[model samples]
Target: MSLAGKVAIVTGSGRGLGLAYAQELAAQGASVIVNDVDAATAAEAVAAIEAAGGTASAVVAPVGPSATAKALVDAAFERYGRLDILVTNAGVLRDTVLWKMSDDDFDTVVDVHLRGTFTCVREAASRMREQGEGGRIICIGSPTGQRGNFGQTNYAAAKAGIVGMVRTWAMELKKAGITANAVIPVAATAMTATVPYFHAAVEAEAKGEAMPAFFRHDLGFGDAGDVAPLIAHLASDAAAGVTGQAIGVGGDRLQLWSHPEPVATAYREGGWDAAALSEEFDAIVGERLQSVGEKFPPLPEELQPPQA
Candidate 1:
């Protein structure tokens, strides 16, 4: 996991998981650019990395839109001379049920998570293509989007969209020797603290108790640091062969999610009418649609955030 001579940019690196990622990459011999909307925290983060014998600079800008995206890449080039590993970890959360969710909430989350990710990816890809040394693109994803979560219609849509971007970019960028992947982390961080179960776990930790199993994931046992090493592994040359994957990392656990694909299909001499389609729908696909959570054993209910 030695990223010697590599230049990396980690958005939202002022604190939490992003801060952990920046420090680890720097420790592994990469020059890092710590990006965050907060000037103080971003500067503080850079200072910490530099104090630890690593090279880093702070860029205070909200992630999203082409201009801010360009600024991030520009900072990397100006300070480090090149960019190699880009971790799109900048985001904001606006959680609410669809009916109660405000337009501002929906727009802001999508702006930060979906559009912001694309803007950064677009700029990074353009430069990586010209640099010709190949690079790594690691995007942040969430289980909420993978399995769906209540009161997260907007967040879920954004995260699911991220996986799609990672897959598409992996295919398109591999020709340039670049790899794209998404990492889903189950760790205790400010963003997740908004969710009840994770917040409860955070509280328990404050009391000097172990995180409860109901809200646990392998390798991600309520520690933001748990997510850092995996990011390092993905960004390093050793993981060049791994691409277009959706991987989960947390408290002593690492797992790959199955890509969605057709499990069943049906055909007829001609397209079936509504009447025929209704009669045959269950016969054709009901088995594939059977509930796995209840029948095959669902994940522990604690994985879900407690109802508001």
Candidate 2:
């Protein structure tokens, strides 16, 4: 969709997936306000967009605080005169098993990913409501958020909370025509590059070689750019009817995730006590218990890293 004359904001757009999202939005003719804590990379992102003949401005600030959120929205209005889309892509990973995860690790991830999405969406939605025009609020999520992941208690919790907020905002902002959705993206970035499972593919990509098809198709892993088109589409007028949904995207995969709902039901006369319910609980509802955590297929021999 062409976003001509539209003004958008992408948080943490300095590099990786955030930068890709900002660039894609600009490429579609949207004037983008790029937010990042690092001034140097933020300027570089703006320069890259301008070099490609797209409109963009940089806002160098951390994304958790209300002040930063306000600054980003203000920049959009001041630089482009209107706000239409917001991509909450700022995040951090302080991964550790539940027992080893420190309070700071938990709070830090929550502050940036969860609280940042909250503050930014709240500000943007408020202005969009006042402007009396429909808008788009796209939040970032992770597969870990949908299903538990090892050593990702903080990241998973924050990302999951973001999706929860998006669902809530979809209902609250419907009357004003503001649509809210979460994008669960998988790609080879600085983050995933550290994962042992992805090392071979990531190394191949760093050497300027194309990633294996297995990564793109089976694992749904590719470059960061692979996930940006979904963001652009969600931001467009065409997606007005698509809200309160968690969408997954990657190399060649596009997924529509199901919301949590009761998969089984049972009735008891006068509400049976705990002992009786415990006896029958598994027999009735446990058969349909859903699996948790992400399931990756077996890796091919050709894609494996060579033995040293």
Candidate 3:
């Protein structure tokens, strides 16, 4: 997936998945603008790309539906004189059950993930229109939004909202040659380390200690580099026609998710009264409903503590 002569802006690219995306794109010949809230990380990412014989610059700004979002797009133009790809990858995790989640937590997640995506897209789309060249717009999403996850109400809702926005952008920008798509990634990064067990394992590995049993199976899929190929492909001319869809990516797996639609319905001649619904509810809708959440499998007994 050669991106020769192209320029890209990848938000939150100072580290982890975002860094992988930026580096891969640059490695394929695209000049990159690395965006991150942390100045040091952003600079380090840029240095890494330069060391790999690629062109890059860093932007340290607060991520949100604010000037910072537009600044990312502007920085891309400043560095390369054109912007051809925009990846809204900046985000933060605020995990907790809905009942225990605070209003601030929910708002903070939405502000960074959803609103940030919108503002960045808004600026990039406008510039792409002015340049009269279609561009690639990729939004980073999460599976939590597709199949509900425990303790991720805010993050899930924000990711789901990103898909909706990208769908609309795809339709509206098709004639202009723009493609908008979402990637639901599963990679181990600082964000996922918020889970204590995952963090402990990362620390142990850093010190060359024996790892937990699950580290070779479920946890082995933590490499952020595994996600770069799909991102690079999507940002290339090869995927010009693939838009308005959510694609799942992790390890060696790639999945295309179905868009929402009416799977089953019942029509009542008089628009069903409460009594009629009481009689037909199960037959009409309840019976067709699928499972709505995800669950983690239990660890093997040997991986657990000794019996009390």
lDDT of 3: 0.85
Of the pair 1 and 2, which is ahead by TM-score?
2
CA lDDT of 70 in candidate 1? Answer: 98
Candidate 2: residue 165 lDDT (0-100):
94
- Give me the overall lDDT of model 1: 0.87
The residue-by-residue lDDT of candidate 3 on 1-308, one tens digit each, is 68999999999999888999999999999999998888888899999999999999998997895698778888878878999999999999888898999999999999999999999999999999888989999999988888888888899899999999999999999999999999988766776555544554556546766556474445444457768989999999999889999998765567799999888977989898999999999988887898777555566655543344
Backbone clashes counted, model 1: 8
Which residue pairs clash in candidate 1?
218-250, 218-251, 219-250, 219-251, 219-252, 219-253, 220-250, 220-251
Pick the TM-score winner: 2
* RMSD (Cα, Å) of model 3: 3.0
Candidate 2: segments with Cα more than 4 A from true spot? none
Q: Rank the candidate models, highest lDDT first.
A: 2, 1, 3
Name the TM-score of candidate 2: 0.97
Q: Highest lDDT: which candidate?
A: 2
